[model samples]
Target: MTVISVHVPKTGGSSFLDILRKNYGAKLLVDYGLEATTALAAMTSGEHEIVHGHFVADKYVDVQGARYITWLRDPIQRLFSHYQFWQRNKFPRSPFWRQQYYNNFTFEEFAFSPAVRNEQARYLGGMDIKTFSCIGITEFFVESMELFSKSLGMDIELDNLPQHRVNTLSKKGYELDDKGLRAALYEFHSLDYQLYIQGLEVFKSQYSQVSGCLDTRFWDLQKSSQKSFPPQFSLQKLLAEKQVSNVIGTYYYGDGWPINMWDTFRRDVVDEYLDEVRSDGFNTIILLFPMSLFKLKSSNQKAHEIFYNDLVFLLDKIRDKGLNFMFRLGYSWDGFPLSGDRGRVAFSVLCEGSSKDEFIEEARQLYLIAETYSEFLYGFITWEDLLMFPCNRAPKASEPMRIQLATELGFTGNSGAIPERDSGEFLGYLEFLDIKFTDLFMDLAVAFPRLSAEVRVDTTPYNDSDGGEHHYVHHRQFVETDCDVIGTYFATYMLPEKPTLNDMKRILSFVHRQLQVSDPSKKIFIDQLLLVIDESIGKGYSTISEKVIDAFVKWFPEWLDANSIGYATWAFCDYVWDVIFNGTFRYGPLGWEFGGNTMLVESAETRYVQMESGAWLRGGRILHFEPWPQRGCIQIELEVDDACSITVELSDSYTVELDKRDMSQVSSGKRQVITTEFEIVPEYLKILINGGAAKIYRVGLGKEISSCGGRDLNMNHRVTSRLIRELNNNYGGNC
Candidate 1:
């Protein structure tokens, strides 16, 4: 059998040929620019093993028992490289270059030229993608080689092959100059783009089929070869730490223009806050990139450039701060209208009407953006509340709007007779939406397997202490979607009283069991752990002074280590600060600030408590606490700045500071007043000042409130009663 290599120009064909030659040696039958069909016909008996050349698939159709192989590339990049090559080499002797047509043509003109448009597809002679024994992608050449070598039943030395990044045009700063031309070229080569997309699908399918034949070490080698931006904290170093407590991080929330936020972001404030985060022992930050924002500028070169530059800037800064970054696509909490942009309206309309192809295409564009930045990306979370369907009611639409959305979703029935909420048709519509989202999630996971792509759902039912029914539909969707990570957001506390460290573990254990049964492959995680210091419940309630933060800090790491799931605080900063500082994200009833929840209790002070002697302690601030039932003693932790005499005292009484020289004995470099009995117990404790400045880490209140695993406490009765009444009123059930 003859092995035919169809060498598509500028698609790593030259590099591939070098590998082919190394393997086939004298048995390789080369055409060397001669008519490939003629060369094949002229090949002697020994040369029958391999007949490789740059020829269309048709040229080899009659060659008896020939197996064809080829490599394809991104059409736009390939075209740009082709143009740049001619400009650089003057094609040496090509008739077109000799005529100066290549020299005179602009890239835009060259891109759409009849000679090269859709060149990859043309080279294949419109043959079916499956016609080839093997197809590879130039962009992922190493991975392609592994598959190709396996198919050929040979050991291809991939490491020995030199990298081929030939004739790359002025793409480095193309956006700065002739920005519109890139968009023009993209439009001009839409056929090539579609062909490339099809080629990727083909290549991916082939790779999956032969992947089991690959050596485990060979897969590792491929991973080592993947391009990575230099990280402030290398993934190797971060992964080596193996401390579950380090995983406690928060999604950034505040002050940027959410609509293209990077355009006018406050990097200095973020830098300061991130400095606080690092010092506080957090390791990751999540950024939101809206699909509509990217799609709205699909053809706008300037917008694309701005978005790219801003994203790069933010990512680099995050790296500089030694914080890992994850991103969620589809919606930016910024003021981008849900239906304002054409893409959003298109997706929303399509989703409502169930236009699968259009919605998938929209999702494809979004993932393409992810692919571009996959090097810096750590993971992906689905859009906030995307899985919360039926919960989020679509806006009331005018007759025209309803018709438009209905028409877009491909509704064929009478528009005026659209199914009502309680109707079977409407339920079917919801199910369709669920399935589409699942498909979208699975596609991203497959397309970008390197990144941790997953869905984060509201797992409120699983964490609830009320013994309510779980969101069965939501759970089913997540399980069927098969996301890489199953992230949960306990918007409100699952338990009525503050969940103990043990309670948190129990909650997560139940969740893990559920996910393991559904999809054992998915990594379970807690995306949002609410940090509520003091919450009120109607007429009667309970307050746990500072133990909320304490219990979480103390027990969370153990929970993470035991279950091997990641955890992040609800937010790093207050939600209201965005409205106050940036005046963005100002939607009433939907505003984040309206519900106050964040890790940062006060403006700049992060609630970081050091775990020492089985207690979480915080330093450097005035202390505030409310005795749940009665007054109690305090345990104070202080870090002094300098050698100075001082007095430590509560508002009701005082205690003289210890010798400054004795501070040397304090481990972790902080002085402590462990279980210091307060003579007069006040309703609210206060740390009165004296001489030297001290960082007050913690003022642990004793005898405030106690419970049985956060159930049947002072606040639990009030909350349980209210919740029972609410549930009965809503669903007409007895408690």
Candidate 2:
């Protein structure tokens, strides 16, 4: 029974999502609560049997072997509901309200802005959405839900309808007086008011108020088949435990990019030891190649070819072992597969006013790479800012004419261009530049497929009513509450002052939770991705501390889920050679130092991992041995049954009930931490013992977990990100 519901927010769409969850179990779909609207809805297609969530267009509505259904609210009422939602949330710096911290809206000023007036009017008119099959008003939410059930030859009970899916801020945060809020709601929600009136009129002529023609009570059958599911932590543990291997392999490095001149770009030599890369069953590699963006220079430049060739050579070897590759595509900037042409580097500025053709030509060059290489490519990255600005309702299709034009050239645009912005501190003096980047890019997505980017932020540096500066006073309450930079680009809030072991654990956890998906094929991509991050980021910054570095290395399986984020990395050492590299586990002495005899050893790869405050600590060497005869089993303890809880932080997707026990598993003994059981069959493809060095690549844990110290990720070596350096430094270590 495949269920696909194309959800359009506001028209009580969540009511249906809630119902489906109650019946089918919440794990049936990705958890929207832990993610932003973009990532929450990423990769979900309307075509799936029961894939439903704010799917506004048909392109996103396609389902394979499933039902196709949708519900819509009266246009005007939907518009007003949208308006009220913004009003309820008090538009964060919306032009109509206040871009400033104070409630500085002049009634007249609020009444004039396009987001407030024209856009609202378009919404209220119901003129924007025309493709919905069952259109009704919120007043008839129960009936509409009934119609939805009947459309699919089923029955439902409306009693379990979730009240207000979006949990909004408290009254104190909105900063609105009761009276003022009432006024704003009344004025903005006018469409709902009028539409209700009109809908009432229509209902009178169509059917009695409650004639019992349909089963409203039966709708409870739709009570999320998955509500109140088990915690995903168990599944997370299971996954981490299953991804065992002594090697930290690299993906897309070795491409001899000039920027990587400082590290050991030896992924090319990794081919001599596939057994080592496949060590401990955690076989990983970072593909080293580039999109056509810099094809001209990459092909022509000697140094660039050397690095890229090395990366490709690694890929060919990894594939030879019949292993899948997780290809992470870097965007206009952000150096993963280094570019020979510096002009192509990230944060690149394109003409905000470029014509459709110009944008398409360039965009086409990029999009084709993703489309053409979809098979080997496990994830098609939307952006690399890794920095996202948290704001609801990014520029709609009608906006960003130029960027929209770029999308018309054929590529989906995303609203993740800008990173999270704080209320007081500006984005330096580049606010204008940020705006330009978003304005032009989003416009392109509208015209093309979808545009995406990244975001980063920490909830520190804030003020209270008391207004006493408590800079780093060591307050857990403050870390969890006060001074937090809400609306973080990814709603990311780090609690680090300097890189720490806990920070890496936090980031690892964050990425896994946000990247959960229901497909096994997707898991294959995730398995490959882990190998990538270990390489790129791990290799790029090699001078950091061991605690931070080890923590990152120890708990790397955290962020692996996602909404279409593939991964890869650059350079790495020999897998067999590095497995036994960490002989004594010295912070400074650890890491794949330039010249070392990579050998397999039994060790935990020594890094700090978070535990339940009083959880028993079995301190000893955690020997990473091999990938399961199967794929995607993290090197940790996990349960796979009835109701499973799991987190894939890289994609920021979390799930409570994951009974799917086919793909992975883990095991441990008094001292033997070996990964032999796999969620695979035939038992022939598991990781085997081999003598070789490991490789490196860049795969992101679909999350933004932080170090206990809450250090910044951008800086080279605060203990927080020292794991990256440590991994790179000891490019020849093994578990």
Candidate 3:
């Protein structure tokens, strides 16, 4: 039988032809005729074992004893290699080169050219794909060749075959980094991309069955090949173990999406964004599932299937980028925010008259879906909407309604058995709601013990000093429940402008004290910390300065590690409409403000630096300083302008309760010096200037010895770090 190797350009055709020449010697037919038809005719008259040349498979369909064989490649990579090859071979002396070279084509132009667009599919156009005796991949050349040789009964020596890498870019340079150009190229050759993906699936199916025939030596060659070209099957790098300090992430808020359904199908857009996320040093992404999936009104299984498929696709992409996914299950879609039919069904479970079985089934389905992706799944955050107060007021449910809620939650004995909501036997109605809230979490905790089912609560009136209703009592009751992780939706910008610095300190202290008093061992997670800066809110900057970013990076981690394993920012990327700001009331980059606070720009550049121990914050309106990571003391020399006031506080342990005391304050036009002294080393320090202006001349961490006996007890060992270390020891660490 005569072997017909149809040469698809840039699919290792030339290299395979070289191998054929080596194997067959004089008997190999190497384009003996000037034209394809003439070549077939020449093959008929000769004693040739192989006929190799650039020709379509259809051209030789009628030829007797013709067996077609070819190789394929990843279309995007092939096109890139093709462009680079042409650019390298642009010789002015040759006529073909002179014409093309004078045109000075870009890689984009060459990629979009009609001559080579989807050229492989076009070359094999009319023939059934299975008709070819062996179709191989250029990426996995060794494996493909082994399969090709075995199928065709050819003597291809794996050890001796020359693997020539022609016109290849380095691993990093291989990808099309330009988002716009990459997008244009993908759109232009969308058909080829689909074919390539299909081909990969086919190749994988064939590869597994052919394993019985694969020589032991073939894997040895594969291992060697991987040293340079890397195996095609493994695209993503193995994820590294996350550091205690750098495990920071963001809530990919589905509600903030411009449309209810995002075109996550766009490979170029998603790839670019994921790369940006990886570059930002985040190891986790919390994908908030849209509430449309849970809506009782629409049981569109097709829509569910489509979304699940999309989620799996996005998860694969996320994993390939070496990031873990935390599923935030069942939040309402922004287009139809969980009201009416949807809201009623969800709330009925939490309210008095509802089916406990329906609620359990809902939780069960979410748990099952989560289990399917346990490989990449890190944890889960339960629906946050359950904590909403009607009309933004406390305890809309009356005492009778609260009793009904407790009954629904299966609370035994008397509601009076629980502590009163307030000291005076007044407002005991609110305490009943907390009891129900605890029951809901306890139910989920028992059902999904495998994952750390974190409950994210709203920390409204962040500080008790506001004289408004404080939710700390509710928070204390919730943390005391069986929740695996404690989390809250808090933003520093929510504090009053005058007491911004002091209020932040108080909020953190209250949280720490609650954690210590309840169960210090429980892990905490800041589900959302807004990173925005608005001039209208006295933020006074269009974009954040390195100083502001530095202070946040330096202090936020210390604050988090004191109580929790990690924290996440409010958002990663979002789409905005009309004006950037909705009103004169400018706000920070939290999800609630400016419509969107995308951490990454379209180009994948970050608005802030990745913070760590060695991170620096210098040269801005705020002075540079080293933070007392262990010893929370701070000393500052300030130059206050006329009518300006400055506020400063140290964040240490709960025992200090610095918020209850006021020591340092600076007034206008005077030089003032202040030093903080607490019972223990503080983990964070805050400074805010109000009125005209103020300049921090110098600031630095305190070197004074700790009086609390040792480093703050809260941070002696990180819960996340220990957990990861144990996981790594159990399962081979990386990836």
**Per-residue lDDT for 93-157 in model 3, tens only?**
65644655678877666777777777877877667666676777776677777777777766887
lDDT of 2 by residue, 106-221 (tens): 44344433454433233323532332333443445656655555555444665655444222211112232354544455466455434443333333223222232222221111
Range of the 10 consecutive residues with the lowest summed lDDT in candidate 2: 696-705
- Selected candidate, larger lDDT, 1 vs 2: 1
Please give the ranking of all candidate structures by lDDT, highest first, separated by commas.
Answer: 1, 3, 2
Clashing pairs in 3: 532-588, 532-589, 631-682, 632-681, 632-682
lDDT of each: 0.49, 0.33, 0.48
lDDT tens digits by residue: candidate 1, 1-735 = 577788888888887777777888888776657775467576535445876667776776767777888888767667777878887885546676664463588866676677786788888887877778898876666778888889988678767656443223212512313436545554566566656666655675577566622223222222221111111123223334543233455666433323434322444466676675555445677776555444434444544554555567666767787666666555434433223332344255224233333434544544565545423334453434353322233324445664565444433333332344434344344444444454345454444443333433334433123434443334345453323455565434444465555665565566566656654655555666653445553232223335544444445555455554466655553321111111111111111121111121222322222222112112112122333324444444455545433333434344434434334444444555433334443333333333344444333343321211011133333433332233222221222
* Model 3: CA > 4 A from native: 1-246, 253-268, 296-298, 333-345, 352-359, 372-384, 390-427, 451-471, 482-484, 498-503, 535-549, 577-735
**Which regions of candidate 2 are displaced past 4 Å?**
1-249, 255-270, 273-276, 280-318, 330-377, 382-454, 459-500, 503-571, 574-735
Estimate the TM-score for candidate 3. 0.39
Worst 10 residues of 1 by lDDT: 577-586
- Which residue pairs collide in model 1, if any? 353-409, 618-697, 619-696, 619-697, 620-695, 620-696
Ranked by TM-score from best down, the candidates are: 1, 3, 2
2 against 3, candidate with superior lDDT: 3
What is the Å distance of residue 71 in model 2 from its true position?
23
